[model samples]
Target: MPNTTDIELRGVSFAYEGVPVLEDVNLSIRSRELICVVGPNGGGKTTLLKLILGLLRPDRGEVRLFGGPPRRGRLRVGYMPQYGRYDPQFPVTVTDVVLLGRLGRGGLAGRFAFYRAADRKAARDALALLGMDAAARRPFAALSAGQRQRVLIARALCCQPDLLLLDEPTANVDTVIEARLFEILRELNRRMTIVVVTHDLGFVSQWVQTAVCVNRTVVVHPTSALDGNAIRDLYGDEVRMVRHHDFLSKGGHDDE
Candidate 1:
């Protein structure tokens, strides 16, 4: 079911200086759904997510989130970017990093320091929810790739957002860990709307209920089901999937 309460973008276009990145893209994201945006490199995937996040305004069309602009009610959004590298000697603990998510709610200028009991409780609870309680005091520099990824998600969850946006959530993790991350996202989707941008064909077919493709142009497939034709339409006939099964398998998986 499409979420009745969600975001809608009509004829949206964005450009950097005079060069266009996204051209008249139309999209709608429903509440309580998981949508994946996929495309080749330089395909404006990141640009589109930035538009949803309201970090950049569209050059031509309108974007509405929850009945209004993304900027007006951004606190309800949580975002986790592609895996980030950290300095080994940064000296920040996992708990400290997760606590950063509360900065928005806690206010700025020393406001977070005077945390109410509820705020502290929320941060701790978020860490536990992501299974990071055991490493709450561990230095972020020392955590493994998968553990760090979970911490980033925990940081995002601390906001208790109605919508969560992740860019390349499995970019650096191994396949086993990537599968686990997808499962975690499936569970998360039951509680919040999720929008992910990736080139991973495998995850898209297995997890997403909707697909959005951007390549200077954007197309949205609202139906959860997809076929080889749809895949080829977006990625051309060159991009290949690991497994030899299409989302609507019966037909052998091939980009063409």
Candidate 2:
């Protein structure tokens, strides 16, 4: 049997103030699939993500999440944005940050509920999943860049989402932590569909099964079928393909 569809975009087109972004795009993402979305900067990567999140309405065509309108399925989705700003001196613990995920369960009223015992437990479990439980009481600003990213991911997981979306998750982290993060994501993929927007093609080839190349249009290719020529087609001739082995040879460590 075919896998259940988690996301579908049919002839989707979007433009910002008459400047075209994505046009004539059709794609489908299936359950438990790990996908990497790669494209040039400003080539509609973020636009496509917004469409999937129902944060933007396409100029033309349709977007469906789990066979329904995207808005209808929002609660089942967890999103970690590319850049999030936080005050270094903000008096918030890692556990407190993760509990923010539970706010979606009851909206404003639930947030004001001061986070019930169950919410605390769920947050703790999410932290444990990322091996971040020990840092739960640490001030958010006290963690490293990689640890912060993991905490944000834990926050996303606290929602108990069936689908996880991450944008440039490895952008600010070292190679070792990046590899570890992908290991965590790979484990999560056994139970949830994951879509990540990344520029690290080597990591994509190593970890994900599918690649979605988005420019003015979008094309989906199985990672095994992705070749240097295919990457050049998506990123142009100036782009170079770095093998995963080369990355690891340069003091990059893989998850044990």
Candidate 3:
């Protein structure tokens, strides 16, 4: 039996003010698959994500989520953006932040209703999944960069989404935490489909099953088929490929 596809884009094209950002792109994401999307900065990576999120309408083609219009299935999707800025003195606790995920289902009424006991339980459960339950009462601003990222991920999980999307998840963390984050994501993939937009290729070998390379157009490759030449072809001459072992040891520790 074939795997069910959670997302599909067919001949999709998008442009900003008549300047094309993505053209004739086609891709499909299978349920429970972990996919990494890599591309040069400003090479339509974010644009493609927006299309999948149904935040942007295509100039020419189609995008489908769970075999329907993307927006129709939005509740089943969770998204984490590249940069989320929070004031250091902001008075939000980790649990409070995770509970925001419930807004999608409850909307304004739920907030007015105030979080029910079940909602609080779900938020705490999500935090536990990321090993962040202990920090539930801590201020969001006091956590380390990695901790904050994990909390945001927990917030996404609070939605109980079938599909999760993250952009540059490891951008600000140290190598150890970066490795740990991927380990967490690998575990999450067993239950939910995940699409990550990242420049790092190290995780490709051990975690991601597929890679989507985006430029003006998009191409998908099995993780095993990715190589130095293929990466160079996608990223051009300025790019370099370092073996996974060069940075990560056999025990999965950063060699630094």
Candidate 4:
């Protein structure tokens, strides 16, 4: 088994400009679990992520990681942001980007050194795991969208994190690439806990064992067993759930 439950949000609340985004949010994620968070566009999904990363503080209650504060929790967490936006002119190569993940474990000066042989090996191994070893020496700007995403994930994995947090790991990819990405995620989750925020509810139900549905308030489901009424209540009419009978009659596939 893994260490402690890797994450906990204790009655957390957050607001901006006097308007609340998350209220009375309480959640606990155990080690080696794969959880998917789903809701409408502005349902505080990202806000919850920020709270767990300590990028934002809760207005009312505490957020803890490994039984401590989030900043102190950094050593155990690996975070993959929704978008990778470095400039093409930037001089970093894929190796350099992945090596950045080692900084937390190796100290601030680790990036400048040749890096310990073990650390370099760890970075290379992470790349291989993500199937991005060929692009390891390529300039980060030269890779395609899916390749870039895999590299970012490789970078996060280089941290040897116990808990990995991802925001829209499949956001802009086509269907085929998204399927491949989730396959990788399943393998990763066997060793590390994963918490991802995504709008693609169907994509996660295929693999995730837990669901966190958030709006102003948050609810937890054992699986992605959300019904039409629950979907309507969470996202309103503009994003209602599809009816199974109607969808089947129309020959609509579940993967759509």
Off by over 4 Å in 1: 85-89, 106-112, 227-256
Model 2 lDDT per residue over 137-191, tens place: 9999899877888888888889889999988888778888788888988998998
RMSD of each: 6.6, 6.8, 7.0, 6.5
Residue 131 miss distance in model 4 (angstroms): 1.9
Clash totals, every prediction: 0, 0, 0, 0
Candidates ranked, most accurate by lDDT first:
2, 3, 4, 1
For candidate 3, the C-alpha RMSD (Å) to the true structure equals 7.0
Model 1, 122-240: lDDT tens per residue?
A: 77898887678999899998998778877888888887888888877766667887777778888889888998877686555767778886667877765533666765554453243
Q: Note the Cα lDDT for every prediction shown.
A: 0.76, 0.83, 0.81, 0.79
Worst 10 residues of 1 by lDDT: 237-246
TM-score against native, each model: 0.81, 0.83, 0.83, 0.83
lDDT of candidate 2 at residue 185, scale 0 to 100: 89
Question: Which is the leading candidate under lDDT?
Answer: 2
Using lDDT as the measure, name the better of candidate 1 and candidate 3.
Answer: 3
lDDT of 4 by residue, 138-183 (tens): 9988988777777888888899898888887777778887777778
